[model samples]
Target: MTSEAKETGSGLTAELKELCQAVSEDFAMLASLHNKEPDAELLRLLRDERFPEGLGLRLVEERGAQAVAFMQRALSALPDQMGQADLDELAADYADIYLNHGIQASPLESVWTDDENLVCQDSMFQVREWYQQHGLMSTDWRIIPDDHLVLQLQFLSHLFAAGKTMDDLREIARFMDEHLLRWLTSFAERVAGRCATPYFAGIALLTGAYSEELRELLVSILDEPRPSPEEIEDKMRPRRVEEPVEVKFMPGMGPVV
Candidate 1:
């Protein structure tokens, strides 16, 4: 790698480490929604409007709105249903969209590009190679072929949180720009449009919100500017794109000790 590329890679890796650290906290709070039954404390917290934190609460609310909007439009598109049949059919239909219908490919920049391997071409491969170089390997849950989105975010969060070198920040920023930010905004919007429940809707909104924050941080590091909340609006606009230099990983890589 060139000197500049090395610097950028290290910087970005550090940022990803930081983000990976936050994943635990973020997921801990968000996963509360999955509780099978709510007790008095949970009920009280939800009723008091104090369960979700500031940004999280806002994200949740936006998701709720998006969900309702999607459901309303979807309901309008379908033939009329009886009162009892309405919710069951809607739920079934919504589940079908994600599970049965084919989803876009993962870990492929080409999926997001109209052209062949545009931004950060083979950059993901570089990342995979980087993982091996650093003595890191994908976990059982995060297999090589296709890692889950949530796991990827969590890993990045922790990586960025612990890693603070300038070299690490740059690499992570580029990764965020070329990979995560490049597609998450549209994905979130599409998810919002498709979901029929406030629970799922909120997840979509939260995804976009987090992506915005990550993009700002990445840009700030790349340009040597301080990222602010106001700077995140730029995510909606297109900017100059960069291609990742090719890097290779040996087979049967193991996790960093």
Candidate 2:
């Protein structure tokens, strides 16, 4: 590659890292807001932006689609507009779905990963390693679990700040390809049909969108040596449920042959 090409590649990589930071920060803010009810000003903004006239409506609609897709798997997915009673009901239902089904709906590592055997290298398993390597513990202060998307975003945030070497950038890129984006697509697909509420449904849709953008940005940073873009397909495998898996139940956690 010419010196100019090298400089361009470096520039692209920097842009990709910045994109990752943007998406991560967006989700981190969301995770915080999810735990707390927004004040009147925020609520007014949400309502206005959600209405037909707001200029940024498409972004909201696109994200809404992702959320509904995620929730429609198990429940009667609805639109964003709902009364206070509906909101309460939806929240309660979501809580139950999360509690009763647990891993059945979303599996943390240990599921679909055979890291213990040392013969396979699932990206999800790699994320666990990354967390421990960075000394990110799962204490109560952490709002999300160890493997949640929000936490992964936080990890990337830390990486972006401490990044000083090309090796650091490469490591971060590897983490994105192997871990965060690797399993999240499949994970989101599984979640799409699990909920009935439009709110979470919107979340799922936006979640997938966010995941797609993040993955593309990371892969772009990778700059494949020979393989063309056409060769790459979706990064996740389709999940099948034989029995009616309960909440919290995860697949592929047992011993690998």
Winning model by TM-score: 2
All candidates: CA RMSD (Å):
14.3, 12.8
Residue by residue across 29-143, what tens digits does model 1's lDDT show? 4333321222334434543553334322233345444543443343334333334455465445344433343333233333353246343344345445545554445454223
Model 2: ten consecutive residues of lowest lDDT: 1-10
lDDT of 1 at 77: 45
lDDT of 2: 0.48
Q: Which candidate is the best by lDDT?
A: 2
Model 1 weakest lDDT span, ten residues long: 1-10
TM-score of each: 0.48, 0.55
User: Which portions of model 2 show Cα errors greater than 4 Å?
Assistant: 1-21, 33-45, 49-83, 112-128, 140-145, 161-166, 225-257
**Candidate 1: residue 104 Cα off by (Å):** 6.8
Report the lDDT tens digits of candidate 2 across residue range 1-257.
Answer: 00111111233356545554555455554444333333344444555554212312123345554453443332323334556776566556456434344325542432433335222235444565676676555453234345555556567666654554556667766666555655565655655556654554444455556555544444555564422323222333324458854455348675333
